[model samples]
Target: MASNMGIQIGNAWFQRKINLRPQHRGVHLVTEEILRQVPELLQFSVGLCHIQILHTSASLALNESWDPDVRDDMEMMLNKIIPEDMPYRHSCEGPDDMPAHVKACFLGSSLSIPITDGKLALGTWQGVWLCEHRNNAGSRRRGFILIAKMASPRNQSRRPFTVCIEGNIGSGKTTFLNNFKQFNNTMVLQEPVELWRNVEGMNLLDLMYKDPGRYACLFQSYVQLTMLQLHTMKSPLPYKIMERSVYSARCFIENMKRTNVLKEVEATVLEKWYDWCINHALIETDLIVYLRTTPDIVYKRMRARARQEENLVSLEYLEQVHQIHEDWLYHRTLFDVPAPVIILDADQSMEEMFVQFEKCKTRIFERCRQSERESRLLTSPVSSPKIGAASE
Candidate 1:
């Protein structure tokens, strides 16, 4: 839909998850199957559509749609490349299982296609393919996240400049947010630790710490929901600061998966929800203030502060958390950094930390001011030039 001012409306972004019917061990054309489920695709004029298959045994691709022989040949080629009868250790499921994993990795799991005039801008011979590697796989789930520029003025004022304080467990994020609370036009939101400690008289945080294998999923689910709420909460102030974010929760999930605390299915489900919330909700962070501290330093701090729930927190756990944070925010290897990061040495004293905070404060204020200017520019009406008027 176009507005009276000749701007596109109501189709800026769209997301949907669909199930593809189970297929044999072959590459099959699924372009129509996907498009049928997402009729909203027609609403987009120009944008990019990203389709991601959620299974490790099945993958997605764009390839020849005209001939069945092409699809068969592709599947045959993949099997030859990663044959099933190899010396594989991960063969508990079946011979095809390990090879399926390898095949999915080779073919990849997602596709990004350009949208033009309410249609997928694929070449004449191109179509989407679902390369099902397993012979008896269940229905495959795929998520579609799309974005298109709207014709409306980009009024960024409604969206405040959000900063997420990220760090290890005892890296003084609460202290950092506390120091900034004195600033005018800034809204400081601390993490809902109290909520986690007493969720309807159940100490979820303590339970997870005590028996992670039993309650890790339950604890993390609540945490993800609460973090999502914080991220999407509205504030009248121009600058919004949060103690942590959904992105950090994703990092936690990754660590849990790596440490075998979360089963693959459970992790995949959480990740799918994360992807959906990030795309569908108003959760955007402009900056990330990472309080970088070594595992040993934070372990000492945790022991000193000595919360009962964290009594079970060992230095080994802190080390794993530290490495995950480093890989994410510092090394930039594990996951996507949601925003630009400003690493601060958090192993310093309160006085030194305040100095670092002051520097970050300057940057935040500048971003807030810039957002205000852009809002004003977008909202201000354009003045018509006077016709036949004398030149100044």
Candidate 2:
């Protein structure tokens, strides 16, 4: 069963795949075709739009839009640089097949352009060109990913202030979320660990721990998909809190890369997807609450909880995970920090942890109120002073 997979944010993010009508092999201007297919581009004021061709025989480039001679010269130059008359071994598809692939590689397969004032910020003389290398190439498919930033009206309901709780395995994250359950107007999203435990009655978590070399890539891929689902979910409350986020998922994948569980190609593909999601998706994080704890403390807690899949987990592994989290969230030297962080000592006992949660609650609510005030100020209309009446 074929299924559609991708992310979209109300007017902020847009993604689509469209097939261009067949054209004779040449460098043809395609800016109009693209704009016609993706009218959503008009909704963005300030953003980036990325277009990637799905085929290797064709490519995309930004060049002269006004004169036809410029495009003709470009195609003439490409053919000269890589001629079809040359004898090539990989000619099963035709004489132009190998040269087409090479031309596509030389010119590249993707182009990213900035968007301003709900339109492509192309220079007056620049336009998108579709370089067709083959003689009778059919319709070509291109994927578009667009992201924008828009201000909300003062009376409009804004997206909830989101918080992501990050910690090592069994770092009292579940306990912390439970404490927030009593508060009204707040939505708490826990990690989908249960789904990991039984994916169609197969324990992927157990397989990963038992044989990481074989299952790490598979496990992490599914994890990323699930985390994306969580990140894009809508909340009806004023505040949204999640146990772990897509950013934290990257930390685990990085750990797998460092441990040699994931190969370089596998890691690269995952990292690229992660980068795209972070940059283009609508996964917003206003604050990150890091439950900082020692490996020994968490290991003890994990053992006490006695989860079946975690029986093989060791303190050594937990230490590595701890350091990765520290490098990412605390040191701020690894990937980008999506939001402000609030570090808490999670080594306390249950009673003490509750007290800590109480203190953190106050800060969280205060930030929420402050954000509301700022949003009002930004969305409220500015009034001009009366010319004759007020002179303070």
Candidate 3:
């Protein structure tokens, strides 16, 4: 397993070692074979995917999952990494040697991907590309090593998948998710906005007055159910888009924990789910859209939305949510939340905001696909027990 300190193996769900002649392009051929054999590797829950090109003139890229347009775009993008017109000293072997290394470095020497449900943890539009950046025409052996292990069905299925969107309550999660549902192949896993549904036989006024503790538990259940709901859905039905994911669960849990309302069992389950989501969630498309807004703007937007939940949402509550969003962003940036983040000023015009969203479409869709693959791999039924969090 330890081939070398820096040199490690790729995850087995999808891996390959192939001999390639120079001037080879078009999906690297061997990647298809590797992907074809992925179902067998899905048995393993944890592993690293290592890929090394023996030749200096080739590199690997993962931008062409199932679309030719994306592939073309990526190819065009690579052309800029090392310009053909740029001066180079290492042209003795070929014009591409130095540039190839430059290009490879630009792409990456290796990538570590998670394995779940018998598939590679790549997005739908993401694919393994062996960028043959050289002009030499000799056979070069490329190596790909996959390291992975099998996990039990219980661990895999029970693992929760969360997608968190941090913004003030009026920060357009509902609108974004609704629009996201139209073109996104992913599922719409909605956050439980109705606190009333969380508690049995308790009115909002009661929650405001008597047992805020009960309200917290009910809300936590709703949060847990929201996370669990993503896994419960039979996929092949488009990956899911959870309006608020486990991170939000953490946000709420912290509130309850501070209030001493979290029970032992609840704490255990919440911890388990949180750990699983952080580790195995394959959260590439998991975005944190920060709708930066002032308190007045937040209140105005909340009022405009006119939802029942917003009725009791006082200025103090809105301020708290705003503070949480700020805290979430700070921690997210510090720890590197597992996805690309898009920040849109709340004041931006709808047309401008949409244009910005369009600019990020390629990255977003690819992340979605990657997240889906990860979810499948983690949730797929397995026959044996496994150790470590889903992330590990």
Candidate 4:
């Protein structure tokens, strides 16, 4: 038999394979004892765990609820997609056979799961299952591969070298923006919704947790007003930062489209508004940063802020908003925008996240300068000296 190839690099790699025979039914042991069997597989903090089934008709999984019914449901679904006895040119093996390989290949032969707390981060109902689709369930010598990396402490004080944050209400945008303002040689620009805080008949509070269908016009109108006031006609301050941009209004509308909240007529109006901003708005971004947080966190932080409008927000409603934000950003990535995008996971603390922002800024500025130098070389009549002395 051929040996399985593997390699470990640094203090953060782990792998082990377990052999299984055909007809070996029932849950196989996945305890620390199995890990102890491989002496070289230890010594990593936290990383990805990847497993591959060697046989074409075999597979692996973390069974949910340990229920046979779930397995039956999965098998039924796969068979529907690729029937066993349908076509048979490849029947060189057997009638119910080669297609079994086809089926397994289609279904997938590997899985990668995150490892945390020194164990796989599977839910209570989940378990690892090695599936065998071949009739010959003899000792088939199936294998398991475990990979890991060492976990290091989170960076708590990383500054925002370049940062731009945007999100819906109670989404922790301001909280993150303030932290960025405090670090680096920073100047902060805040969103201008404060002006609409006193608009009469505006039930901004109701819009916080309810469907945005009825309030889209009002919200966008208010957004336009705020942008008009916030965007200075003059050039932005050097090294200064903005919380939201003129383009963010388009992002909000894209989010509304994902939730079925914006009607056809509303979408038309929003497109016009977006075109106007693109053609006429003074706003420009060095890097666009998006904050993604769970709705549960949004509501929790909303209540923490003690705002009357945000007090009544519910977990379920905020979940919808979270989904909207996720979908919107995903669709936005399909387009080629003028600026680079940096997506920040909002679950981290202020200090930890700032470090990430700073790293992004450093990378972005380096790229920007490189692009400028290349452009000068391409367009200039003569070459200038390189910015630095020759390397040793």
Winning candidate number (lDDT) = 2
lDDT, candidate 3, equals: 0.54
How far out, in Å, is residue 353 in model 1? 0.5
> Which candidate leads the pack in TM-score?
2
Model 1 — which ten-residue stretch has the worst lDDT?
Answer: 1-10
- lDDT per residue as tens, model 2, 1-392: 01133434443555655545556888999887666444445445567788888788988899999999999999999999999988899999999999999999999988988876556889999999989999977544333333333321111146888999999998999899988877756767778675565454467889999999888888888888777867776554678888899999998998888888899999998898888888888899899999999999999999998988898998989999999999998998988898999999999998998889999999999999999999899989998888888667
> Model 3 reaches what TM-score against the true structure?
0.44
Candidate lDDT scores, in order, read 0.79, 0.80, 0.54, 0.57
Measured against the true structure, the TM-scores of the candidates, in listed sequence, are 0.57, 0.60, 0.44, 0.46
Residue 98, model 1, lDDT: 93
Worst 10 residues of 2 by lDDT: 147-156
Model 4 worst lDDT run, 10 consecutive residues: 153-162
Better of 2 and 3 by lDDT: 2
TM-score of 1: 0.57
Clashes of each: 0, 0, 26, 21
Scanning candidate 3 in windows of ten residues, the lowest lDDT window is 1-10
lDDT tens digits by residue: candidate 1, 47-158: 7778887788888888999989999899889988999889999999889999999888988988888876556899999999988899887544333332334222222336
Q: State the lDDT of candidate 4 residue by residue for 50-151, as single tens digits.
A: 767777776665666456687667766766776776867888777657766776676577777766533466787766666566666556633445544544
